[model samples]
Target: MKRNLREKTKRNIGLDLTRIFAFLSVISVHFFLNTGFYKIPLRGKRMFILATLRTSFMVCVPLFLLLTGYLVSAKKIPLEIGNLKKYYKKIIPVLLSYGIGMTVIFAIYRLRGDRSYNLQKLVFGILGYKEYSWYVNMYIGLFLLSPFLTNIWASIGDKKTHLALIAVFSLLTVGPTVFNVNDLTSLKAIFAAYDDNKINHLLPGWWYNIYPLTYFFLGAYLRTYVDFKKLRPAKVFLALILIIFASSAYNIWRSHGGSFQIRLWNSWGSLQNTASSICVFILINTLAPERVNEKIERFLAYISKLTFAAYILSALSDKLVYSFVNANLGSVKESMPYLPIIILSSATLALAMAAGVEFLTEKILEKSVREK
Candidate 1:
């Protein structure tokens, strides 16, 4: 029993490494996309390559959702009420942190003579309204639904039944847009309006949420029903490779045909996001040499602890670093060859700053609670 427990703990650690790497992939993709690095000469091809890489990492969000389902749905049919309450407490800090970070960014933008501030926009963004905040909104929505979803998972006895449900949801997610169904126009229109002309309403809300919860449930289902211990590592690696190739080819084809819309196709399907996530998962789980994996695991764990801080600081770091670099070096185009160096430096500075802020926040919280 002790041995079994130890093995389980190791597996969990491995999983955490997977999650952290996925998050890093997300950061890298966003950094490149937002910095206009993709627009560099011959960068389109490079972007395509990165997109392929990104798709593999796209699986990361789903992996996280899967972790949520497994953790939340442990025991009983339809969920235990106690678990719901517990998760609510757990998610509060995440929401609050994201809120505080968003406010900081908003204030900075406003102070920089950007001149755009509205209560509704602020509230909406806080609620995961537009841009990257959508992930937060999706997470909040999933947390709210977890109890019911957990219940559904508990009651379903057969694997086929759960898989069938997933298929139905995926179809509901992809069908209307794929076929361009006019009847569903109202549904699309409603979401568009609700998201304030943003693409939030499409695909059962889960897809707009990047289907993280759906993937989470799927992972939990597999964990509960399947005995993956008997599976060969090579098989898993091969399967991941195949999936990456297929997803990349499909994305490239779609992109070339001009049939791709950023919100619907690129963002939703995100071939790179999906592929990179798969590759990372498989590599971490299988091909990574023992010593290498241990080092990586440690590094990823450190980064994961600082991920929220890094995200918040990235915005500020971008502004500060860009200003400094511009002041010293003139146009980015002229300094094109040093772009990678700039990104690396900026990211390092941001990570350090974020870590400092997080450490201070934790110390303050500890003191406040002690006083209370």
Candidate 2:
């Protein structure tokens, strides 16, 4: 019994550390995106440095989905109203924080004499729509669809079918996305006939965006069936190194010539990105220790509480933070010397702001509910 308890504690520590890594990676990705670090007019050494870091963190979103699947599957709970209620109980507080943050941001935008508010923007912000929290929206969709998803998983009961499903999703989402083949004659003509309005074009775009669900399923399947802990560590490490190298090489090669937008879109959906993400997920899971000291465990727990808040609030305030950084840093050379410092400072600032906003908002909401 004592041995079992020790093993379980170790597993929990591993899981917590992965969540923390995923949280930090997401922030790092946003830092690059908002600051336009990748698009900086740099060459040779500077560009190489930026590209390496960018490639390293490309696994952020996939890691998130995989972790989500791993935890949800471990629950082995019935996907009923209670599950959803529990989800919303957690989600709504986060959304409320996001809403409060956005209000302040929009007010700042207004104060800056920028009156570009539109109906679409309003709806997106108010409804927590598919603008910034795209992942959150996708996860919510999965939550709503969990019953059917789990039932299908149980019914299939084979690895081949799971692989087949993954392949189909990849073809639909990753294939067209990476290859930039959505505008092909076949696809265009099909979409032209299907919708004169051209809303979805030829293929159903929603099906392609179901990549998160694919990751969720893949993560759950691996956790349930794969004894990754028993795998040869040397081989797993080699495979991970190869995957990262290939993915980074492919990204560098593909950066030859394109507008930044085109490059960004393709890189995010590339096959190499998928391979790298899965590799990182497995690497993190397999290498996570079965034990950690109390100090580390407590630190992980504290930061994990702020992950969702950090994501939403940072995203909402990215533009402002970017502007502030650009104003202070001025040029690449000036900022390059202390780039790590800048990133750490900005991330810390974001975390502090997110925590404050969440705490105050939660109190206000709770007080209002109590009074009513």
lDDT of 2 by residue, 1-372 (tens): 998886665536656767778777776777666666656543566665666667777777777777777776655446577865765565566667767766655666667777875545666675764335766666667765665666566667788887887677777767645444333456545333222243323444445666777777777787777776886667877887787766555555545422122342345545666777777777676787766777887777767766766766665455666677779876444566666666666567667777777787879889988999
lDDT of 2: 0.65
Model 2's number of clashes is 3
Looking at candidate 1, the ten consecutive residues that score lowest on lDDT are: 191-200
lDDT tens per residue, model 1, 297-352: 67766766676656655666667677766677655344445666766766676677
Q: What's the distance in Å from true for residue 56, model 2?
A: 2.0
RMSD of 2: 6.0
RMSD of 1: 7.0
